[model samples]
Target: MRRAPRRRGPLSTVVGIVLLALMLFPVYWMVNASLQPTGNTLRGGWFPLRPDLGGYATALRDQGRNLVTSLVVALGSVLLSLALAAPAAYALARFRLRGTDLVLLGILITQTVPGIVVANALYGAYADLGLLNSCLGLILADSTAGVPFAIVLLHTSMRSIPGEIVEAAQLDGAGRLRVLRSVVLPLSRNALITAAVFTFLFTWGDLLFALTLTTTGTVRPVTLGVYQYIGAHTNQWNAVMATTVLAAVPAAVLLVVAQRFVTTAATDGALR
Candidate 1:
């Protein structure tokens, strides 16, 4: 027998809508502010009945390069973090190595350290290695934020894979590397996507490394661009808000596009 889907009551639905509206009001406010004329955002009305697109034009003209820099760094960080984390996660999950618990504990401990501390330390190293003000430096620094968490996420998911499955692969004359590449990775797609999404978001929104590692306008990320914009004591509030909205678009789009995969990754451990 099929079970009927449970439907929410009218009052519950109404409350949910109200809560959703409340949560999104800030976003609405940002859009409203962005559409207002320069220097008049504070006096602007709630809705943009006569929307002015000047702010968007200004933002695109001034911050377009920063947006591209952010995208490159974020994407690079995701690739590097996943490459390093996935293999470590798989090894830790499948092998009974000595001090594995200690290694896991250390990974967890890295999360407790403040990001500014990491940035400060990397600043000197980057300067010495001539990596300062470079996209590679930004990617390497930001990967720290994602690698540890990704390792944990992938390890937990990989552990739930049945022993028989791995053993069967080995019995079929598959080498360890082949088994991992052909079977393990294919089965952990959800977890990989989840980790990649989070890593991209972390790197895209990162400001510490972007600020500390770069000293010039040549390599500024959007976050640093926003910081500099507000610091300049300018009255162009609309441009500021527009840039912010643009910066937030990637995270929102990723969540929307990968909504199903993210939900499945959270609930499902691994391939059955």
Candidate 2:
């Protein structure tokens, strides 16, 4: 199920490079702004000749706990999504059950629903259950998106596994769980990694649920922390930019490290 790489002309390549630069200019500006001196507005130069660390110092001093909270929530969401998604994906992929398509369609529909709607809907239930301002609540809130996404990606990869291989494992005394662990999961490694990375990114970047579910500052994630920071210190754009840059680090690192696996997973899902 390999896809052929399309050839790009030099002109097209140049055009792509230009387009990419345009897209990434804002990111470059963010880093540039973060390195600039504290100011009332974005007045950074084209390049930071005399980069400052004061903004980062301020961000770390004030929002360090919130960064940790974001990490905890994102990691928790990834673990929970994988735990729930792997088994569910296996069932959906391997079992030729009736209404599987319907179930998948339901999940797809959920993705289309706006985050605000889900947050508003969950607020009342979270309030009633006294789960507000709790890490567990945020993890659960984030998982609403992560789980279905993981299931979809993992299911696609698992579906590409040979049924004969699964059958052989079962005949060799492997239970369904055993087969999933030993056979399907190993075969779907790329997709699993891709799902985990994206789930972390999603949960890390989440703000709507953070705002809607939590009340007090006791359990704020970095996103909420940065949001409130902006309101409190409007003049300190450098600190705000620095905090955002720090927040984006994990996601950027994950994407760079796992990009090959993600590409392979996408190719498999598309071609096979």
Worst 10 residues of 1 by lDDT: 263-272
Candidate 1 stretches greater than 4 Å from native: 1-10, 269-272
Candidate 1 lDDT (Cα, 0 to 1): 0.92
Clash counts for all predictions: 0, 0
Structural similarity to truth (TM-score) of each candidate? 0.93, 0.93
Q: On residues 26-127, what C-alpha lDDT tens digit does candidate 1 reach at each position?
A: 999999999999985889998999999899899999999999999999999999999999999999999989999999999999999999999999998998
User: Candidate 2's error at 189, in angstroms?
Assistant: 0.6
Query: What is candidate 2's CA lDDT for residue 185?
Result: 86
